[model samples]
Target: MQESKWWKNAVVYQIYPRSFKDSNGDGIGDLQGIIRKLDYLKELGVDAIWLSPVCRSPQDDNGYDISDYRDIDSMFGSLKDMEELIKEAEERNIRIIMDLVLNHSSDEHLWFIEARKSRENPYHDYYVWRDGTEGLPPNDMRACFGGSAWEWVPELSQYYFHQFSVKQPDLNWENPKLRQEIYDMILWWMEKGVGGFRLDVIDQIAKEPDLKITNNGPRLHEYIRELSKETFRKGDLITVGEAWGANTELAKLYSNPDGSEFSMVFQFEHINLDQQPDKEKWDLAPLDFLKLKQVFAKWQRELYRTGWNSLFWNNHDLPRIVSRWGNDKEYREKSAKMLATLLHGMQGTPYIYQGEELGMTNAEFEIEDYRDIETLNVYHERLEKGYQKEDILNSIHAKGRDNARTPMQWDDSPNAGFSEGTPWIRVNGNYREINAKQEMADKGSVFHYYKKLIGLRKTYEVFADGKFELLLEEDKDIFAYTRTSEGEKLLIICNFHEKEVPFLLPEGWSGKEEILIANYNEIAETEKLRPYEARIYRKA
Candidate 1:
């Protein structure tokens, strides 16, 4: 049997600081705002909090482009505030997980500034640079934000590569000095008592741009292993890598039993089901429920004991789960709870995005209301491609990252109680009906349902170490599975649509079962589940 780890069963709550809460009416959420909410997170029962970037930045890529790794941005707060937050959260038994963006740095970073000065500068090799052929870039490779990936720097008479925005230059992992600096920075944070880290775009760090290779590079595992030995291996920390290109085979190398790379990787195979396989994310396609089942089941079964998995449906870069997969209109609460049950029942560490517990739906934003860089870039790119404004808007409404960046709904007050002043981003208009204050006051709210799910994971070992087996694989409207561990068997059934569905017990399963948890108040023994209903049963 594999040895136990704290993060194996722990629940992580991801907080996008800018939208969580504002302190001192700054119109932006800060470390102090998170410190103020530690008690609330404790009540919600999350074991750790994954805070997005708070480092010094120019707001390019929303802090992913770090200007300085050693200081907090003034827009959020001071370094003292971060220290206090770490201490306060520790007192509440909640560990802080920092978002580490090691793949790139802001163009304003000291090293980048120095690198652009001249070719003979010691810092010139700190970033990926190549001599342009004739007058154009080395190749026509496109940036993630829609232009040529290579940007011209006249001072050096060369081009620097950036996988993302031009302002965020990719760091050269081939530089040993840069790697040492990163290791030292990580150790500095760990010494300050952070519980873990979430590596941003980690898989792309060893990218071979010259060969047109972006992720899962040839030296990827070698670099990751070196990183583990130099930093993560030194402490009992939980590390999750954002590997959009990782598959089942590659995931094993990342989260193998030896723990040489990371604790687990955040794979997008399941999330990309609704996207056209050969096209960009903006290209819409109906989600294939069967394919979704296959993706989840394959990962769950393959990584059962060989590696680990990170379970999550909502995050800062994606649309709300309730709005994307479930019926967010009339069956909002029911579908939210149903989706939570389906994911939490799997064997992995669950992540709950801020306000996700409140059943927060996607924002109804106009073109002018969008603030995310990716969203705006795609909107304009689609328009330039001659796509209709309505079609582009509809796709943005369905898949825009801004949908997840709206201010958190705290209460039915001015600005959703997120800020006393105008918010940096527009608040979701439905905050009056779906806010934390209102949900916490009602026992039947989605907030309480999520609280129960978090508690169940801690109380039941089956949820952590159980073997997962998908049931009713061909059923279009029902996602059903069974988890078994140490003579304990749990049958989880979820009705995914807005219609009644009959769930017949699989062969060898007896009718004498105890209801562990259910979304509906009354569940009839007739095996007929109502719209968006979820039930977990244990054989009695």
Candidate 2:
């Protein structure tokens, strides 16, 4: 069975290390802080933890810019602390998954340092470098953070390609020697007992003949196959690739049945529903429910037989799903539960981002209070291009990465119990009512609801191996689907709106249905669904 794999039945929790918790009063989260929370995660019912980058870095892009792949940064803790954390997590039966960034490295990395020295340096070919166009950059391609993708170096009389910030130069995967280095580093981590890796922007590793095209380069699958053969295939490791612009066909190739590359891939189509057409991510608009349903249906049906899917709404980079997709102000709890039910009921692995289980809302921080470099850079650029400050701030509120990066709310104490001192970033103001301490104390809160949802995934084999079929495909206000495996079939219905809606059961589906789960205290006794209500039923 495709879903029989260890990770397919596992509910993964993503932890943004810098914002999870702070130990030693540094006001920044650390390895020891994660150790302190292992029991909490275990209690929450997550089987694996995927940590954002924690390797040695200059922190230019919030730890994505790695300088040393072998050691932990002093900001997080020493390598010994990481080892201890891993051991502690294992004791709790939770696997640890490190975020691996193979596409690029910090400009301060030793390899990049040597590569920038001169053409004669052996490491010069470690990164993508080309001669300058009469002092101008080699191409007009824009990096993810904005500005030209190429940076010139006078010492080498050449420009280096950087797909992200200028501080993060793209690595040359064409160099077999560099690939060997990456493989060795991954093997070292696996030897330390890391259960798996979450590859960051993995699809961006291979570019076309020129540096302009963004994702899904020509040799992308070749590089992934080699990496998988050398690293992941050596063990029962779970690897997921973050393919930002990848569609179903490309996703299948990266995560095919042959186990050539990754166990699954994170696709961005559904999440980009609210992004304005012909505009950047900051240009916010309402999500089209029809389009959202179509994207999910397409991925579920296309990837069912050969590949796997990584189901997630909130992550380190995107804004909180409740705020972006649901009503954050009025129906926060209900909408959060609805979103969770819809996600977990799908035939894929579910990922819970930090604070998501507590139904944490987005931070309504003013532009000045935001800490994410991408948010600030985008804001300033848009303002310079004649966008009003208020409009830009509103857009930032709707789509800024800081919405998901705010300090995790543990309690109602100072800094929401995230830090004793001033936090690296501002904590959300509503933590007093939405913190985990409060939610865990209330059995009916979002925390306990998420626990139940996760438990269902482990208890029911159908959730893992069943074939997905979308129901009421044209319904915009409600999302309904069914999963059938063998003689068992489950019907999941979710009200995506804040108003009640009447839903009729599909034809040829008349039978005594057992209520498997629901967001409310009890399943509704009528055909009408409550606002933001969700229910799962199993047919005998």
Candidate 2 regions off by >4 Å? 1-4, 209-211, 508-511
Tell me the tens digit of each residue's lDDT in model 2 across 1-540. 122369889999999999999998888999999999998999999999999999999989888899999999999999999999889999998989999998999999999999988898989888998897645877678887778888988877898889899999999988999999999999999999998899999988887427476578878889999999888888887889998878888889988878888899988888878978988888778898999999999999999988999999989888898988888888999999999999999988899999999989888887779888778888888889999999988888888889998999999999999999889999999999899889989999999999999999998999999999999888879999999999888999899999999988787565358888888886656888999999898974
lDDT, model 1: 0.91
lDDT by residue (1-540, candidate 1, tens digit) is 122478988999999999998988979998899898889899999999999999999987889999999999998899999999999999999999999999999999999999998999999999999997546998888998778999998767799999999999999999999999999999999999988999999999998998999888899999999999899888888999999888889999999878788899899888889988899888999889999898999999999999899999999999999999998999999999999999999998899999899999999799898888778888888789899999999899999998999999999999999999889889989989899999999999999999999998998899998999999889999999999999798999899889998888788776567887899998777877899989888862
Model 1 clashing residue pairs (backbone) = none
Error of 2 at 486 (Å): 0.5
TM-score of each: 0.97, 0.97
- What's each prediction's clash count? 0, 0
Q: Give the worst 10-residue stretch by lDDT in candidate 1.
A: 1-10
Candidate 1's displacement at residue 486, Å, is: 1.6
Candidate 2 residue pairs in backbone clash? none
User: Best-fitting candidate, measured by lDDT?
Assistant: 1
Residue 471 lDDT (model 2): 92
